[model samples]
Target: MTQVEARDSRGTEGSPDPESGTRRARVRRAVGALSRPGPWKRGRLLATPAALLGLLMLLHAHITDRGGLGSLVESMLPWFGVFVPVLLAGALWRRSASAVVALLLPVVVWLSLFGGLLVDKSHAGGDLTLVSHNVGAGNTDPAATARDLTASGADLLALEEITSQARGVYEQELAKTFPHHTVLGTVGLWSKLPLSDTRAVDIQQDVGPLGDAKSDDQKLPYNRALRTTVATDEGPLAVYVAHLGSVRVMPRNGFWTDSRDRNATALAKALATERNERVVLLGDLNGTMDDRAFAGITAQLHSVQDEAGNGFGFSWPAKFPVARIDQILVRGVEPESSWVLPATGSDHLPVAAGISW
Candidate 1:
């Protein structure tokens, strides 16, 4: 063979193939680009904020509620995810590898906290179907709201914010479908099964200074919660219907929740003493399950929506719901399905859940 042919057959001793050399150069360029100061440092502003967002979510429960700020944040915690995309866009625009990588922290934390809620976990059958609604006192058409509720085919219905004037309207409208019913002040429960041992639950009775100042006569008008026993085939089921006091944000008082928080505490005490093995609490609690104020209540009962619902099941401000303040919580039963009902005449939409004994 010729010298060139012989050399070619033997291959080059020290020289790499052109393709392999090109690959090595490309890899080195990539490594150098990533290792450079600019790529790592360009979006420090964005990266820091992204990391803080993740930390905020990771430690939201530890946040202080001295001025109700913690509850406010926890109430809207899920919405914080909206920032992820915004930060991601900024990272891409800045070509920031660090910023992009930082985003993974929040994304993972958010998914860890609320990812299961996004999936459809509802099942088909249940022993009971119950619905709860805060039929607004300002609702002009209680009759129409009653009609809409009856169409739900629920076995039990709990109504909150029932006005003195509309009590007769609801009682009359719902009597045919739900034969057994009780209305104690502003909250009421109507059931297809037998109801007994019904009593008004004074959620504001022990609300410290504010409660002490009010006389029994004065407090009667503000009674907005109740407890009752519904006789189901499975046995006596204890039911609590409540409309906790409203929260307000005033200029002087940061997120004012004194009334609601007190009411929640009183209601929790009532729940702790309950002797019934199976219990269901339905109402417009005026706060989400995540809020620390409901820690007492949430500790004993589990949210049906969280257990067996599709998505977040937001039910307030009927126009555009962003939170699941209207809740159906149960103890000693399995949640088969949970959902948000369509808007009625009230500002708040209804929420429903089906449970099996």
Candidate 2:
């Protein structure tokens, strides 16, 4: 019945439980705070769109062509893989689980498609060496470009877009290093070894009544393809030098590469019917190997750069190469190494590959 007893009756008992109750309250508050959403939620939500787009791009091949534009994008489809790294950086910065998971989709798809090309399969030595370049129709310094390519220590050189004006400069400059050279129309082949059985390759886009055809009565020879046999230590190697017609993605025209595509088809057929088993195609194809338009050529030959180069080895737009319009495809020969040479005055950087029998 004293003060202690009165306090106990009022539920404010003189006990050691107040501190424990306060501790339990603080623990509950900490648990509640820990259960709240984190920064990763924002990243996860933001990554949904990109993940969906990645899924869509995975089926780029299935996308129907819209007047030849689809093939252009499909040809560079593997380039989209570059975005995955940027996405990964964002995911890491935001501590995102969903973003990271989404990134895996593009990574897998890209690797499955082009991982082999990223590998370094080049050998130590090669028997034959070659270089290919589009020496632009408007190149300002043909002599400089010729010197640059000649310095590459290649056994053979194939040039595209050799204008009548600049062809002389190249011919004069290259004559010292490449003793054996031939120019057929705008395309030309210069080799250190002896060349024989050289001829102009037809590149007319005659579609009969369906498409327009122009007569070459003047024999001005706008032919953009050539073939020659180069006698080397490894025997005769049949080489085709070509410059496919340029393509323009005009607003009205929409992937206007009709002449280029037609020329590609003709070139493919010519390559298919080649009598020589050892063949090398070097030129500015104006389309990538991934393009179905080049199926005929690709079916018979393999890209040396894709097989033996260190990286993507892009060679167009010498200032900032984005794609490898120039190429070196080979058959019945082993590619030892492939690489992109430094830029010259020309619009395109030269591409080179080494091979052996």
Candidate 3:
């Protein structure tokens, strides 16, 4: 044997294989890698605010309705979903995994509650079509607005905030198509079909907590509401047109003060006692469907747009509708489809609903 050959044999004997040593080095490197702190720590810290906000929004329903603010807030529950996108944008800007995950809480909550409403249930036809608009008291051009409304081809038209000055303009413009119509106070119902039993329903407005008894002369002709029955081919459909008391948010005062709350109660009472089986209430309700004050009405009647519409049919502030204060609520009638019509001269966009049966 050569001198080099003997030395090589000795070095190789009882030592680890090259492949085995390589594996050991790799295991050490992996261990070191696992021990290092990653971005998770920062992600979790940054997600804290979003997590708390999401939790609050998730339980918005259970939030105390002590102040008028809670009910008002719940009216816009779906709007809380807007926060999710904002948070997601922040997460992307900060590159936070946990923040993005935290947003799922509100996203899931909003979708879980209102997901069905987002679906499009519109159909091609319906038995009856109605349009409800709050043609603002200060509408610039009532005749033009009336012309636009008449063009929609609605069978029944309910108009609120119908000022005495503009009433003739609408009546003259709508007279051709809507021959059978009744105007009782600020609200009026114009129908293509015959109407009966039309009267100004006493919503018992809040004159004052302690004041002299108001007589017919002392009170406005129709303070806030009216009811009538329309003779439809389907059957006699009870119709109500109303402009509920306005709600105001003042700096010193609070939201949805007791006046609107009281009017809601009176309106609910009138509706509960309605003699007709099939009824439709159309007007500027001054409150969203989510407002607890309207629970009495909502329990009996459902919003057509909410149950069977493509999207949020916000009708107030025609320029940029944010909330659907104007409403078309129905009972014993199946809503085929619901939608908001294009803006007119009024502050509110006209909302319509088609129903069957």
Candidate 4:
């Protein structure tokens, strides 16, 4: 036989091809390594952290609030996702099957908690458009803030942190858009519809240990919540406007939310006893709805943002908002759409929601 014939015969007889042999060997090695028990035993360090993160998200409510750590974590619970990618990178670098499997827990838990918020659930049109803003007490240009609010075309407006000095500016600037209005201490309600049964809600700001020491005059400034009735064509809609106490993070005390928690409890109680069938709460709650401290309030009213907003709708620290502390929650009404307004002259961006009867 000729040389070419001999080469064909050798190929047909399965002569060992170095490249093909190398490829088969590599495949076998990869399969063997994956099937081996050694990979499951590797990356214990990565596995431990991944397991802890999953448990933290799963049992965040069970975590103790001894140093207000529970509240702090819950407030930023959604952000816990930042660790998942880091853990995944480590798992990939280590090529540990166990670490990759462990990561499934946190991924599932986080998605279960906040995945819905990532979707857009809003629809067009509603009976009333309500806007709530903190309006910052230190706002230098109250007139401009009021104008921005008026431009929102809201049927009802709730303003919190309205200082006595700038109150008149807001009143003057917003009067044309919102004809019927009431200012109770620092909290106020402005509406195109007639308002009645307007009164200050004692959110127990002056009933606490330190608050008890203050006189009536001193307690006047702490009046940061109100209740009012807006006579809509549908019916008399009970409205609540509130600015819960500020939260602080101190080196010694950790997450200091005593004041805000007290206010939330008091507000929840008030909501529990509300006679009105249709209720709407608009405010700067000073805490996210996910925090356990608002369990009482959250149990009664569902957030419009959660129901109808496009995203998380975080409304605090307008320059770089990281949380949705400003809220419009409702009971006995349908939320049509929810959105965050443009930044005003305050620290908070206004939140608005349209509700139907």
Candidate 4 structure quality by residue, lDDT tens digits, 312-353: 999878999989999999999999999999998899999999
Worst 10 residues of 4 by lDDT: 208-217
Q: Give the count of colliding residue pairs in each prediction.
A: 0, 0, 0, 0
Estimated TM-score per prediction?
0.86, 0.84, 0.84, 0.87
lDDT tens string, model 3, 74-178?
777778778778778878877777788877777777888778778897886899899999999888999899999999989999999988899899999999999
CA lDDT, candidate 1, residue 122: 99
> lDDT for each of the candidates?
0.91, 0.82, 0.82, 0.90
Q: Look at candidate 2 and give me any clashing residue pairs.
A: none
**Candidate 1 Cα RMSD (Å):** 7.9
Worst 10 residues of 3 by lDDT: 208-217
RMSD of each: 7.9, 4.9, 6.4, 6.4
List the candidate 4 regions with Cα displacement exceeding 4 Å. 1-37, 206-220
Model 2: number of backbone collisions: 0
The residue-level lDDT of candidate 3 at 57 comes to 67
| lDDT tens digits, residue span 58-97, model 1 | 9999999877899899999999999999999999999999
Alpha-carbon deviation at 71 in model 4, angstroms:
0.7
Candidate 2 segments whose C-alpha is farther than 4 A from its true place: 1-44, 205-221
Top-scoring candidate (lDDT) = 1
